[model samples]
Target: MSFTDELSTVADPLWDAIEGHPMVERLGAGTLSTDPFEYWVRQDYVYLVDYARVFAYGAGTAPDVARMGTFAELLDSTINTEMDLHRAYAAEFGISEAELEATEASPTTRAYTDFLVRTAATGSFGDLVAVLLPCMWGFNETAERLRERGKPDDERYAEWIDTYAGAEFTELTTWCKELMDDVARDASDAERERYRDLFYESGRYEYRFWDAAWRQEGWEL
Candidate 1:
């Protein structure tokens, strides 16, 4: 099996858990409440800020020019394109640009983004890709699954499903998977195991991100 396929096997249960989360299920069905969705939007905006930073690290650490350029493109796309979509989405919920700019990261968002940034900053290129794959791959998978069930009644939710499951995102996920496989081909067994561990932990964090939004979790003083 390809490395990504192997990672999928190991992460299958976590992916199932994430796909079955109430937030995901309800969003797909267009039944989710605004409160949770709003909370998710705010937290994810902050998460993407650091997420773009991780890509900057990836660009810097990449071994070859092609990979570095791809990472740079991803960073630019995230900041310029994706975040623009996010800001527009937030506006639909009455969240102003200033509010989104000022939004604080919840515990889950902080933990997940921090883990990603630290790994990208300190680890090898392979390690960065291993941790990074899950977010794009998982989202594409979730959106595909939702699309399979038919589009949601909520245009907002439907648009989201389309965005992730759409051609551009699908191509991006495929590139990441190919990158992971290429990285693994040159890696030692020990290194592959390390990558697997990081991938699984990233998947776990992805699940927690959803749960945190579902519960609207906040830190207690």
Candidate 2:
């Protein structure tokens, strides 16, 4: 089967979970109020920082030095670009990088990020991609849908939607999908399922993390 077909087969459960999520449904329909979107974005920014770090660690731990170097470069570029994106969003919310970094991630964010890091450190590259792909690919897909559906007229909402759905992000997600597909070619059925579970579980955690952030005290954006 083709890579897209493989992904589609593996991603059915994940797509079902996302479709059933009230937050995603609202966001996709462009009916999510600005406050909730901003709240989710803020939490996402915090989570991505740790997410990038795990990829960095995975890059550092790569068995081959040459492969490690490439992974490191990719991880660094991803981190720097995401940080820049977050900074732009922060400016709109009157938040600072220092403030964002200093704030504690919600419990779900912390657990999910820690899980990714540990998985990267101890698991195969395919496994790492499995854990990472959901956040990378899934978010990009969702954001593009949101953009197509029409981002809220509010400046902050438009900015948030544009950041993830923009050209740079599309390129990033494309890279991730290609990488995962390449790795999946040689994977065992059990390994493939492991990765698929990671993708779906991480996605569900993503929803919970946002819900927690939305309920946090004084989370105005």
Candidate 3:
């Protein structure tokens, strides 16, 4: 098996938790509350801003121009494509783009984005594969299942599900998985193991991110 596949096998438990989380379950059944989803939108709007930066980091860290170009395209698509989706969703919520741009990251949002950027800053380019894979691939897989099972009578929520289940997103995940496999193939045994740990750690945060969105979790003031 390729390195990413191996990591996936080993990391099945954590990934499973994210896939089966209550928030995702609710969303799939059209039973999700608007308040929690709004909180998720606010937090995720900010989360994606930072998420785009990791792509920039990947570009700069790339060993070659082609790799850099891939990251650059991914970065642009993130800011332009994905964030546009957020803006559309925000409009439905009666939130302006300014408000989304101004959103303060809740504690969980901060923790998740911080963990991602820190990994990109301190680790090798290969490490980014582990850190970013769960996000790209996890969302695709989760939403794919949700779409297959379908819920959301609401267009707003249906739009959210359809976006992740769409062709563009599936392609994006495939690209990320390719990048991850390439990185893993070239890694030393020790480094591969370390990347596995990074996968687990980032994945743990992914699961918590859903729980946070479900509860709209915040620090007690």
Candidate 4:
């Protein structure tokens, strides 16, 4: 099996749990309340800022020119294109640009971004890819699955599913998986194990991110 395929096999249970998570299921059904989603949007805006940074780190840490270019393009797209779309979407829910900019990351959002950025900064390029795979792959899988159920009635929710399940996102996910496989191919067994651990940890964070949004989790003290 390809390295990414093997990783997916090991992470299947986490993927299943994420798919069954209440937030994901409700969002797919268009039955989710705006409050939690809005909370998600706010925190996610904050998350994306750091996510873009990880891509920047990826560009720097990339092993080859092609991979470096790809990471650079991703960084640009995330900061310029993706975030603008996010801002427009936030506007639909009465969230202003200032509000999105001012959003304080909840504990979960902070921790997730911190882990990602740290991995991108301190680990090997393969390590970065390992951690990064879950977010892109998981969302594409989730949205594709949701779309398979048919589009949600809520236009906003439907738009989200359409965005992630669209051809561009699918292509990007495929590229990342290919990159992961290439990286894993050259890795020592010990490094492969490290990558696997990071992958599993990131997958856990993916589930918690949705749960945090579902519960609108915030600092207790």
Q: Count clashes in each candidate, considering only residues at least 3 apart in sequence or on different chains.
A: 0, 0, 0, 0
Whichever of 1 and 3 has more lDDT, that candidate is 1
Candidate 2 stretches greater than 4 Å from native = 10-38, 61-70, 217-221
lDDT of each: 0.92, 0.70, 0.87, 0.91
Top-scoring candidate (lDDT)? 1
TM-score against native, each model: 0.98, 0.81, 0.96, 0.97
Cα lDDT tens digits for candidate 1, 1-221: 89888887877888789889999999999999989998988998999999999999999999999999999999999989888878988988888988997987888998999999999988999999999999998899999999999999998899889899999999999999999999999999999999999999998999999999999999896
- The C-alpha stretches of model 4 lying farther than 4 A from their native spots are none
Q: What is the C-alpha lDDT profile of model 2 across 1-221, one tens digit per residue?
A: 75546666656566556545666666556566656665665667777777877778767665578757766776786668766776776767787878767766666667878887888888888888777777767667767767777776656556656877888778878877777777777778898778777776776775666556556535244
C-alpha lDDT of candidate 3 relative to the true structure: 0.87
- The collision pairs in model 1 are none
Candidate with more favorable, higher lDDT: 2 or 3: 3
Candidate 3 lDDT by residue in tens digits, 1-221: 87767877756777578768888888877888889888888889899999999999999999899999999999999999999988888898899999999998889899999999999999999888789998887788888888888657977778888999899999988988888888888879999888888888888888889999998898888
lDDT of 1: 0.92
